[model samples]
Target: MEWSVTDLAERDLYKLLVNTVLPRPIALVTTVNAQGHANAAPFSFFNVFSHAPPLVVLGIEGRDLGDAPLKDTMRNIRATGSFVVNLVDRALVDAMQVCAIDFPGDVDEIAAAGLETAPGRKVAAPRLAASPVQLECRETVSLSLGTRHRNLVVGEIQYIHIRDGAVDERLHVDIDKLDLVGRLHGADWYVTMRDRFQAPRQTLDTWRAQQGALRAKPEGEAP
Candidate 1:
């Protein structure tokens, strides 16, 4: 089946995009308004961007068909200039889903999810105690995308909290220990990090040597 980008409806394109993206990291973001009322919501359209300043991106969509109508997170982030990105692990998956409920802007989803919060050192937004990792970020910029105005919130990581056992002395995070979960297609679909494979990148010298051998092969052969 072929899909023409111009012909496909926005919803259709959105379905294709989310389904084909394989597995995307979930950002259980928390933000607080000036009044200190907290909001927690999940965004699968998120990922790390760079390390130099340590940046992450969250593609937060507005309340469309009333799947979480409260834009409290976005509003708080924009109002306060900071937010927290809490990483979701298998143990806290259900609690994380609880925060996704469409509560009122004044509702406190963190408490609704029955999770504890740790006050962020640098940001007004607090971090989730159940989260294995939390990033306290200050918003750098926000870019509007598409007709629906889905926003791309770019933030520089100001502080990071990693559970004691999740990282080693060498700063190598233990995947099994992290036990992270990723968002898959559909409402409740997800993938775990328990199954993994490693393929080391080859050195330039090794790559050049292999290329030389391939070039030296008889041209008429499989060229």
Candidate 2:
């Protein structure tokens, strides 16, 4: 059941990776072209990588047959040096899919999807008004890989917008209010945050106490 990555076909490798990597966060990224035209796209290959500098990464792939190799999102990010990462919630899922469609460069995906935007505080790109959380980012660096036109973009967050009532004065967030959705296996599959459980970390003292209690019990008795 094991196959070498070098031996596998490109499409097969992609299928294997995407199918096995359960529940990846979706980034409904918004960017503006040089002409100030807005563009929106959904990318599952996205995540918040660091907190010190507040960085996020996006994996953008180019079209196989097209006059322009790079996707509109990638091209816009390169031209503007900024973008917004809008975390998708249950209510925004339909709009997110609409943005995922391969529309012409001239077409405005945000408008087509019937989504409203707010002016970015630090970046040129606009943020989705309905998103639970919107992070305005400036491109830190981008790495081009191979002939496939794949790019790994690293962006530093400048400003963040959280929906009102989702956060408290002490910076505590209410997950139920946030209500974000994530990408699941397959092309059209998605998952909600309703089903989640937390397991707290164990300290050395707590671990030793548990071990002592186990030893104190009699081997033959149910003590």
For each candidate in turn, the TM-score is 0.90, 0.94
For model 1, name the residue pairs that clash.
none
After the best TM-score superposition of candidate 1, give how far the Cα of residue 90 lies from its true spot, in angstroms. 0.4
Those runs of model 1 whose alpha carbons end farther than 4 Å from true positions after fitting are 65-70, 211-223
Candidate 1 residue-pair clash tally:
0
> Candidate 1, residue 143: CA error in Å?
1.2
Worst 10 residues of 1 by lDDT: 63-72
Residue 6, candidate 2: Cα error in Å is: 1.8
Model 2, CA-based lDDT: 0.93
lDDT (Cα, tens digit) per residue for candidate 1, span 35-88: 888888888889999999899999988767556443777878889999999999
Q: Mind sharing the TM-score for model 1?
A: 0.90
